[model samples]
Target: MTRVLITGATGQVGRELVEVFADLEVTALDRAHLDVTHRDDVLDVVRRLRPHVVVNAAAWTDVDGCESDPERAHRVNAESVRWLTEATREVGGHLCHISTDYVFDGTARRPYREDDATNPRSVYGRSKLAGELELDPSATLVRTSWVFGRYGSNVVGTVLRLLDAGAPLRFVDDQVGCPTEAYDLALTIRGLVDARHAGPVHVTNDEPMSWFGFVQRVAAAAGGDPEQVEPIQTADLVPPRPAPRPPYSVLDGSLLHSLDTTAPGDLDRAIERVVAAMRSTVKR
Candidate 1:
């Protein structure tokens, strides 16, 4: 069995990755077991276990929190990857790192390819890009966007909650990007790992839509009123967000053509599956 170690096992993607790689000799660790930010601990764990692969899903994903504390952001997102790279080197293991679309400034007219120049606009984006820089060319970097799943926090649950509560729904129509289900993303990752794919590759639905569009789809999939979602602009946000978001951060799987990988499953069907799964566990 191929030895695989997964970090941040409690996260949405991390959880799905655990399930997807279940057939392997998998060891999943949550933040409690392994804090990637601590260099010595990271080195010790990788050296001790000596897994063939280290899938790093651990990241300080608090975008607003990152803006407030750039130091912690750099440590968790950027510096952590640096340490992981070193540790993986010692073990001679393949490092498969999850990345985000925020690496780009989101201004391009076309979809973002793997080789496009990056101009991260926020602390989170900058830190993530820094993490990407820490990797060797042979390491696998998977970039995705607008991810939702059955676990943890996501827009799918948020939309369902508001719909269930009969609250007014409003979302921005200005920001456009692709939505990726965590389950499908894991499948894509599994393929990449098996192929020993190197360099950056985007994993997302081919088409892009506005945030308002995504919310409507989620509502429809959850048996709620899709039309109930009120479309608004970024400027219409009452308090405004702390971090700068890309207006058009849709990632195109152009590199997928060259690689032995496929994009995630259909967007609508994936949303329906997640919505159904989430509904089953709803508080009675």
Candidate 2:
């Protein structure tokens, strides 16, 4: 059986990845079991098991928190990649790294291609881009945006919760990007691993829409009133966020097309699946 080791196994994407790779000899390590930030521990464990592939889902994903603690962000997000890459290389294993569309400044009117020049605006984005730079040339780099899933707290959940509580929802309408489902991204990662596809690949839903639009869709998907989501400019947010977001972080799946690998289907359908799953879990 193929041996696969998943770091951050309890994360949004990691949880789904663990389920999808059930047929494989997979070692799923949550942060409590394996701290990727600890270089010696990572090397020790990776050298011992020497799995055929290392899927790194570990990251410091709190954008605003990263702004307040850039050093911690570097340690968790960027330095971990370096350690994992070194260890994976020692074992002659393939490394599949997760990245974000935040690497770009989001100033462009057109979608960002795989090879596009990156200009990250926030500390979180800069740190993630640093991790991208640390990857082995042959390693797979998957960049996605606006990810939501059942395993973690995400925008979808926040929207649903706020709506359920009758709280006024104000979302930025200026920033636009793809709302990628974690389950779909995990499936794409599995396919890429099987094919041994290397280099950076942009994976996201086909459509690009505003954050306001996304919340509206989430409201609709969860049987809430979409009109309750008030569309506002980024500047209008009270007690403004610490980290700056890109106005346009839409990723182009042209590489997927060029490689003949179809990106996941529409965002609406993905939202429906996620909402349904969330409801099912709640009912149980």
Candidate 3:
């Protein structure tokens, strides 16, 4: 039996990974159990467990927060990843790290390929890119975008809450990317682990859409009035966010598709599943 150690076990991706890889000798660790930012702690845990794989799902995901505290972000995203990779390599274990689509500058007219030039516009992106570069050949770097799921706070959850509160929502139409479901992403990760596929792979839902279009779909799926969801440019909405967002960061899923490892759900079906799951949680 393969022993797998998962970091950020309480997170959306980590939770889904735990559920998907239940058959494996899985030791799920949150920050309480293992702090990746602490090199000694990470090294100690890996040496103690001696697992076959280390899947790192823990990340400082607050994009705006990263802009304000780049140093902390680097510690959490880049330095921690390097530590984990080195630890895993020392133990002859594979490291599976999750990354974001923000690595791209979003200037591409079409979807971003895996080998495309990475020009990160924000601190979060740069940190994630650095993390990716630190991984060894045994590691798998999975890049996704607009991720949401049932485990924790996400864009879908936030939108639903706003709609339930009868608040007018204005989403930026200028920004575009694939809205990925964490469940699908988790399954894809499991597939890659099982197959021992290495290198950077882009994993996301099949379709891409603007934030306004995505919000509209979410509202419609959640039984909200779509007309109430307004469209605006990124410049129109001024939130006190610290980072600048990519105008377009849609990732090309062709690479994963060629390997027959692409996600099953598209944007429409993904939204439906998310809405159903959220509604079930509310009823409970």
Candidate 4:
């Protein structure tokens, strides 16, 4: 049996990875059980398990919050990655690290390639980029965007909650990127691990669309009124957020194209499944 260790096992992507990797010998550790910042704990765990692969799904994702405390953000997002990478290397296991589209500044009109020059705008992006930089050349890096799914708070879940409360929604129309489902991302990571693919790969549901369009799809999936969701410019946010978002975050599908890996299904279809799963739990 293949032994796979998953860090950040309580996170949205991590949770899905745990479920999907049930057939494998999986040892999942949430923040409580395995804090990545502590090098001793991380090294000890990896040395003990000696897993074939280590999937790092943990990250400090609070964009605006990262600005408030850059130190903490770096510690959680970047510094901890250093220790994790070292630990993974010590165990002679391949590391699969999760990254974000934020590694790029939103200036590019075309989709960003893996080799593209990185210039992150916010502290969160810089920290994540630092994590990417710390990875061993042999480690696999998966950069994803606009993730939503069953285990944690995400754009889809937020829209559903607001719709349930009958709260008016106004999403930014200027910002656009791929909307990825956590389950799909987890499956893709599994394939990459099995193949031991190295270097950065972009994984997201196909097509590029704004958050407004995404919310509309979510509303429709949840059997709510899509037209009720309003569109607004990023500047029009009532209370401005602290971190700046990339206006165009579409990552180039070049790597996925070269590998001939099938892209995840349409964003709307994934949204429907996520909504359905959420609804099932509400009734029980």
For model 2, residues 1-284, the per-residue Cα lDDT tens digits are: 88999999999999999988889999999999999999999999999998999999999899999999999999999999999999999999999999999999999989999999999999999999999999998999999999998879999888877877899999999999999999989988998888888999999986899999999999998988888889999999889999999999999988886775546887888999988888788789
Scanning candidate 1 in windows of ten residues, the lowest lDDT window is: 254-263
What order do candidates take by lDDT, descending?
Answer: 1, 2, 4, 3
lDDT tens per residue, model 1, 47-107: 9999999999999998878999999999999999999999998889999999999999999
Best by TM-score: 1
**Tens digit per residue, CA lDDT, model 4, 1-284:** 99999999999999999998899999999999999989999999999999999999988999999999999999999998899889988878999999999999989999988899999999999999999999999999999999999778888878988999999989999999999999998988888888898999998986799999999999998999999999999999979989999999999877876784555777777999999988887779
Alpha carbon deviation, residue 198, candidate 1 (Å)? 0.6
Off by over 4 Å in 2: none
Local distance difference test, each candidate: 0.93, 0.92, 0.90, 0.91
- Residue runs of model 4 more than 4 Å from their true location after superposition: 260-262
Score residue 185 of candidate 1 by CA lDDT: 93
Query: Which digits, one per residue and each the tens of the lDDT, describe model 3 over residues 102-173?
Result: 999989998999899999999999999999999987688899999889879998888999998998898989
Pairs in clash, predicted candidate 3: none
- Model 3 RMSD vs true structure: 1.2
Q: Which of the two candidates, 1 or 4, achieves a greater lDDT against the reference? A: 1
TM-score of every model? Answer: 0.98, 0.97, 0.97, 0.97
